[model samples]
Target: MRLRKPKLVLIDLDGTLVDSVPDLAYCVDEMMKALGRAPWGEETVRGWVGNGVDRLVMRALTNTLWDDPEDDEFEAAHPIFMKLYAENTSGRSCLYAGVVEGIDYLKGEGLKVGCVTNKAAAFTVPLLKAMGIYEKFDIVVSGDTTPKKKPDPMPLLHAANQLGVKAENCLMVGDSMHDVEAARNAGFQVVCVPYGYNHGVDIREAGPDAVIDSLAELKNLLK
Candidate 1:
């Protein structure tokens, strides 16, 4: 399929630009410990991400899809996880390979860019700044930026609106079904990477416009 040249690019945070699960895992485990619950390790936490922190906490607490933790228990654990996560956000999180070069290429092409992630602004902003990519995005749409998050398309559409670009002229680059569904619903093109979390499913099953092994290859595709 022929791809449109994007006027703006919206990128996902966790599992797309940065592998943030290590720090997220640490916070999840810490929160569990404080709650007198067994800790879910990093590997398990990897599959529970991309949904947003509250959902992540829910998954960590329940350890299965049937996450019906007691409200009081969840409320107490939530703030603890938030505090630990704020402290651990970027210490072990690093940009995946080719991310920097890809960002440079996007900028060189003069495309407006935004970061739209389910991660809350409290963690997203500091993590991006610490990783030296905060300034790369013209706008950063956190989970709380809009009333709804991915798969609903509000955040992606909101990012395009903020960049003053029409949704059809935007491209969303990410690694999960959430990104693909968001871009599709927003009327934007989406490209997925093979190596990131997709709830333990193959990302190709989500049917992105293209599947790239690394962000560096995006330059060639865009060219």
Candidate 2:
């Protein structure tokens, strides 16, 4: 099915643009090991992503999705994760199929593209650069970039403003509910990729405007 086109499109960084779990999982595991805890393997770490580094680290520490880590515990562990992730950000992360082509098609159609993510700018920029897709976005709104991040609509709205496009006239393509909710809140169209992480749940349950198997399908779905 074809979907309405938008003036601008914002992409999510972690699960949407790249499968950063390998590196993220590694860092989390390493940090856990340093803290004298058993490592949380990549499979488990995958479910804890999409929020942000702070949340990810907290989840790793508590071994639960919603519980908060103790102040002293979190303070000590956060920096260890920061260092581990920084030194190995994109070593194993990779772009999914057709990411480049789909992005190229959007630019070819004269659409403005931006990257919005709950990740800190420090890791987002380097990861995108390492994946060779950094220059593709017109703007990047990170977790720390605005007062709020996804699922609250702040980052997406911020990007639309930076790109000089109306929020309702933009599209958000991502993998998780955070993307779907943010787009809905921001009054933008939304699409999802089935292959990306969605907290171990199917992305279709989030009710995005469309769910495509590949990024290349943007050419088929969009105007």
Candidate 3:
């Protein structure tokens, strides 16, 4: 997508900046073991990511999108997963290809950069900091930072407001449809990376403004 030098660039955390499923999968399995359920494995957990921790736990419990775990079970499993995730966050996660270069390019171009993610603040903040990319961001708006998370447009809008930029002048970059839909709903341009977890669906079908393979390539596109 062509842009006239967006005033702000809001990026998604998981699947975009970080391939976080490794730690998430570990936590999911640990939580499942505690609950006496079978481990979902990394492959299954990969497809369940991008939504949120609660949804991921539910998906693990049900093993299918057509069904959901009971609320009581969810309540029981939620904290277990949270505790496990908190202990494991970023321990196995790493940045995706070209993430650092891309963030550097954006900052080098004097663009205001913010990290917007469906991951909760408790997990999001420390992970970014642990990865040494936290200070690179001008602001961070996590899933719990707003009333609603991605696919709701509230988090993106909240980031824009925090950065003092208008939604129309902001650009959203992510790896899933939630990012694209959130950008669309918030009146911002969006680009998607093909490598991220789009809930096991093709991100192209979601129709982002641009489909980029690597974050580093954004340097050439941003003007």
Candidate No. with top lDDT: 2
Q: Flag clash pairs in model 2.
A: none
Candidate structures ordered by TM-score, highest first: 2, 1, 3
Please give the CA lDDT of all the candidate structures.
0.90, 0.91, 0.90
- Those runs of model 3 whose alpha carbons end farther than 4 Å from true positions after fitting are none
Q: Where is model 2 more than 4 Å wrong at Cα?
A: none
lDDT of 2 by residue, 1-223 (tens): 7778888989887887899999999999999999999998999999988788999999999989889989999999999999999899999999998899999999999999999998889988999999999998999898899999889999998888877899778999999998999999999999999888788899999999999987888999996
C-alpha root-mean-square deviation, candidate 3? 1.2
Worst 10 residues of 1 by lDDT: 61-70
> What are the per-residue Cα lDDT tens digits for candidate 1 across 1-223?
4478899988899998999999999999999899888998999999888788888888988887547688997899999998899889999999999999998899999989889998889999999999999999999999888999888899998888777899889999999998999999999999999888888899999999999888888888887
TM-score list, all predictions = 0.96, 0.97, 0.96
TM-score winner between candidates 1 and 2? 2
Identify the leading candidate in terms of TM-score: 2
What tens digits encode model 3's per-residue C-alpha lDDT throughout 1-223?
5565798999999999999999999999998899887888899899888888888888888887647888899899999989898899999999888999999999998899999998889999999998889999999999889889889999888888887899889999999998999999999999999999887788999988888888898877875
Distance from true location, Cα of 189 in model 3, Å: 0.4
